[model samples]
Target: MSSKTVKLLLVGIGGYGHFYIDGIEALADQVELVAIVDPFPAQALDWPTLQAQDIPCFDTLDAFLATGITVDLAVLASPISFHADQSCALMEAGVHVLCEKPIAATIPEVERMREVRDSTGKFLEIGYQWSFSEAVQNLKTDILSGHYGMAQCLSTHVAWPRTSAYYARNSWAGKIHNAQGAPVYDSPVANATAHFLHNMLFVLGETQQSSALPRKIRAECYRVNPIENYDTACLEVETEKGDRILFYTTHAADANDGPSFLYRFEGAEIRYEIGGDIVAYLADGSIKNYGNPEGTHMRKLDVCVAKVLDADGATTPICSIEAASSHTYCVNALQQIPVYTVDPAYLQVKEIKPGEQLTFIPNMGVHLREAFEQQKLFSEMNFPWATPMGAAVVVCPIHS
Candidate 1:
């Protein structure tokens, strides 16, 4: 496979697909952009250049597949509802896939994708940017080597404020289910800030390409915006190993803090803050630094390409579907729990940008930061508007 230029089919170039287009520029010598699959390909920023280069665009994956054009890899940047089916179809047609994160909204979809991937012997790497980064891989390696001892607890805090324009940009941005009734579950944790939530599970994974199975979830789901899904969520997940995972994220936060995480281990405490390095504080009074994970966002494509082409030393174990399913399990469980509507008293609507109005909880970042520091959910911290949801449990027959 390394003897030839790898053929790549780009699925969806409207929004996040730009990342792939940019990545292809860097990998120009190694990969061939065979075709594009998007309902609205012209909407992409690179449409004119691609068209002049004779790159044909199809309105759907099936249309491109029917063309009988061979492809080595298909990067799926489509909506969440389409992930499982698109990936399955591509894999069944003998194409490897690099799917965007969360795997899928339902466990059945995740199972089906994994089954097809296994049967077809194709790698389906989930595009969790951090999971493909050097910093995270090093951290996972250390955890597996028991350098940090047993993981005591892991917590993450992300407060990215998004306005209506963000949600209105696409049909499935804040939707719980798509127009076809397929589960989308697009929320802060599932979509925009998903990298952080999955990072917690990914590092605790038993293997490089797996995530720890979550057995139970206690959460507080809330929304200050009028979106169908909650913009704010605080989840406490209990893994199969009985380790604790606390994740907090809010699109309705008043501030634009990127993401900060603390992973507590018996021998050391690992910490990473936005605009900072992932530093581990050890019991021996020494500090170990893993460079920032954010810089390698485009490396996801390189990692996938290497695996697809079987390049020397590039048979990298990328994040597999089974590994990313942990995030889906937690998300599906969160859907079973109720989402409380934030009362008007605790909410404020502001027009941060013209034609981009946003609904936010006043001082939400501060409140959630407090919860994160103590590894507690909003309800446990006595937020008056926060209502506790009963423990939502997921049964992962594959892992359990």
Candidate 2:
């Protein structure tokens, strides 16, 4: 119950950073917002909030660092590619960092940031927000307590539609690497669907034997839109501990149905479906239902605040840098493989207006589920552009 306040710096006040603002606002007593930084502050819808509060704003990390102003921790809600450099620079300046997810665009970047964190002894936390959810924590506790026994497999399918307007929000919106000469890598798996994949590794890594790292992977990455990155992908990975994860995800589907996951354990089966229901079927012929509480995306920020205020080394951030290495590896591996543009024969371009149109991936839903349930890659399911198992591209650093 320490009331100590951690002076905080807010970086990248646009897009998802709004959640961090909400989280800090909700926990105002535990932390103080010392400053804000974003290259394009005027682009943020919530820019007015910072302006109203009369908080000092800077256009770049260099400018902020030049001021010699510092804080207890910096929340990096910036681009995935910029995470490594920004986090390292801040930590070197005697600040802990909680970076947004996929940790960094590449393994080398993640490794460099880790070196800075180790050398400087500053904390580095990834913003995989679901890891901080009460429901997920209970699930992890159950898994550790042997209530679910050994995990057999984890699979998730998430499809949410996005119009061109969604991509038009920023210059780095849908590019593989930032075309604006910055390291802003934005892909569906690494950026938008990052939570689903990171959550898988986080929960599975909670067990003792599993390091939660991916040992091998086979993936089918396809782009339905004209973006530089893939809009749809199906992945099957084997973890270092011999566990498997089959993930089917995309942003080019017909609807925004939300994400769903199935975790099959030796002793039981838990299905986390859309609308926040956690249903477990046990070996005793009994069923248990847990309502997943909707957590503010900023909740992880709250957890970070509590940790910094208490100065507790024993208690770590919900998603620490080490824990997120596996997730970062997955992103890097996927990036190494070339993205195959979906055959125009399979796309139905619906004209939204004179100049804008939404690219729809035909029949993605059924095939995505089959890939997850059968623990197979999209190519194995006989998609026209899919490559078979032996022929599937393998770009993973660990497996290679």
Which residues of candidate 2, in runs, are more than 4 Å off?
A: 180-185, 206-211, 352-355, 384-395
**Per-residue lDDT over 1-400 for candidate 2, one digit per residue giving the tens place of the 0 to 100 score:** 6777889999998888888888888888888898999988888888887899998999889999999886998999887767889999999999988898878877778789878988988788787777777777777778888788888999999888777877887778888667656555577788888888877887887553223888877787888888888888888877877888888898777767558888899988888877777788998999877667354456777777777877766245466776788877887777777778777887787777777677877767766777777777877778775544422445467566
- Candidate 1 pairs with clashing backbones: none
Checking candidate 2 for backbone clashes, the offending pairs are: none
Model 1 per-residue lDDT tens digits across residues 80-114: 99999999999899888899987888889998997
Among all candidates shown, the one with the greatest lDDT: 1
Query: lDDT for every model?
Result: 0.86, 0.79
> How many steric overlaps are in each model, in order?
0, 0
TM-score for all models, in order of appearance: 0.95, 0.92
